[model samples]
Target: MGQNTNIRGIVQAAVAMTTVGTLTAVSATVSRYPVYGGQAVRYAVAAVILLGVARLRGPRPGPSARWEWPLLAALAATGLAGFNVCIVEGTRYTSPATIGTVVGSVPVVLAVAAPLMEGRRPAARIVAAAAVVTAGAALANGLGGGSLPGLLLALGALAGEVCFSLLALPLLPRLGAVRVSAYSAAAAVPMLLAAGLAVDGTSVLRVPTRGEVAGLGYLSLVVTAGAFIVWYDALGRIGADRAGLFAGLIPVSAVATTMVLGLRSPGMAELGGALLVGLGVIVGLRRSAERPLAVAAPADHHDPAHDEEGHQDQAHDDQHPEDRRFVAEKAADHGV
Candidate 1:
């Protein structure tokens, strides 16, 4: 069951990143739209769809604590809205390759941070694999020069990307992936709209052209809504350290997307980078030779199978004491 869960997580994470990669092709169509306003609409639509799906899936709890609200807002502000804004503005001062190379280091950051955050030592195998993945991603993107401001913005984006997964961990056990996705996406809309009004003025919103509409539709429906759920679900199943390795697939998928669109063909470096990404992921996912100690959950903390939307109950039961304490305290504060 554990192996099966990991496989599902790998596949889901891969699909989610690949879907995000396809955005490179569609983003051009919406390039002329007001960045903040368009993203507001995109996330708004995604929130609605995710909420609907969550409803259909059956009733579940939401963030009940005041702190949880802020956490979700932070996730939206940093990960969703702020990340997009940084990418848009960063491109003005830097090559996309520069930003891509910087953001591509997310795996290494997560591999190290996620374990530490969970009160465990970072797995050597995963950290080494993450380095391999980052190197490959950098090679695929091709290191490029950027201004100081652009470098900073790219770093900001990297932080946002890391937070996108890590922040969701505390919420996942109770809220599940769908609710967290829905709530965070919903939280982002107002923030983006406010930014739009500030940055783009009253002209922030206008009816999009037909092509832009199509592009927004795809982004809202597939890239934002579907991918967010899948990514979060995978994170819950595999843990962030393991799931982070699949981020290397983003550049690989982007290259493949470009090839499919006949926009460009893969060069030797790109092909080699893709191989490294595959190899790194394989290495990271392998069972460690020394299994870490698993802290037993409190007897009273029984989780129904449906509560976490198919999250492996055994996995939750085996969480480190620190993890359980964190969740328990949060749940108590939330009146859950």
Candidate 2:
């Protein structure tokens, strides 16, 4: 059952990232549209779809603590709005490949940072695999020259990508994936709209051309709403470090998308990079007999410490939930 869950998570993460990669193709259609305003509209549409899905899925817990709200806001502000802004501005001063190569380092960041944040040592095997993934992603993207400003903006985008997953780890236990995706998408709309107003002025919300509308629809329904849920759900199942490995697929998928569109044919370098990405993901996801599960209980499992009424024992709430879950899973694995 555990192995099956991990496999499902892997599939989910791969599909989500691949879908995101196709955004490279779709983005051209909306390239002329005002970035902030277009993104605002895209996210607003996504928010509605996600909210509708969440409602149909039945009642789940909402944010109880004040701190979760801020985290969610940060997730929207930095991960969604700021990330797009960085990419748009960065490309003005640098090649897209330059920015992409910089952001390609996400696997390594997540491999090290996720474990450390949970107060565990990073797994040596996973760290090595992450390095391979990053290299593969860079090769796939190819290096390009960029101004210092573009490099800095790329770094900012990288930070945003990392925060998108890490910030949601704590919230998954309570709110699940759908609500978090919905709330963040909803929250991002206002931020993007405000930026649009300040930047694009009265022209911010003009009617989009048919092609632009189609692009926005794809970005909203598939990339934002669908991918967000799958990615977050994968994070819950596989943990961030494992799921992060799939991010390497982004560039590989982008290459494939272009090939299919007949925009470009990938050379030997791109093909080789795709092979490396597969290799890295396979190596990173291998289960170690000696290493412990990152999260103690399966995300779907009811918290043994919490009752049906959703009341938690004081002790459980005081300690970091990840640590507690780790302890619980460890005990179960050992037949304690």
What's the CA error at residue 232 for candidate 1, in Å? 0.6
State TM-scores per candidate.
Answer: 0.88, 0.88
Model 2 TM: 0.88
- Output the number of the TM-score-best candidate: 2
Best candidate per lDDT, number? 2
Candidate 2 regions off by >4 Å?
292-336
Model 1 residue runs over 4 Å out of place are 292-336
lDDT scores in order: 0.85, 0.86
Q: What is the lDDT for 12 in model 2? A: 89
Clash totals for all candidate models: 0, 3
lDDT for residue 143 in candidate 1, whole number 0-100: 73
lDDT of 2 at 158: 99
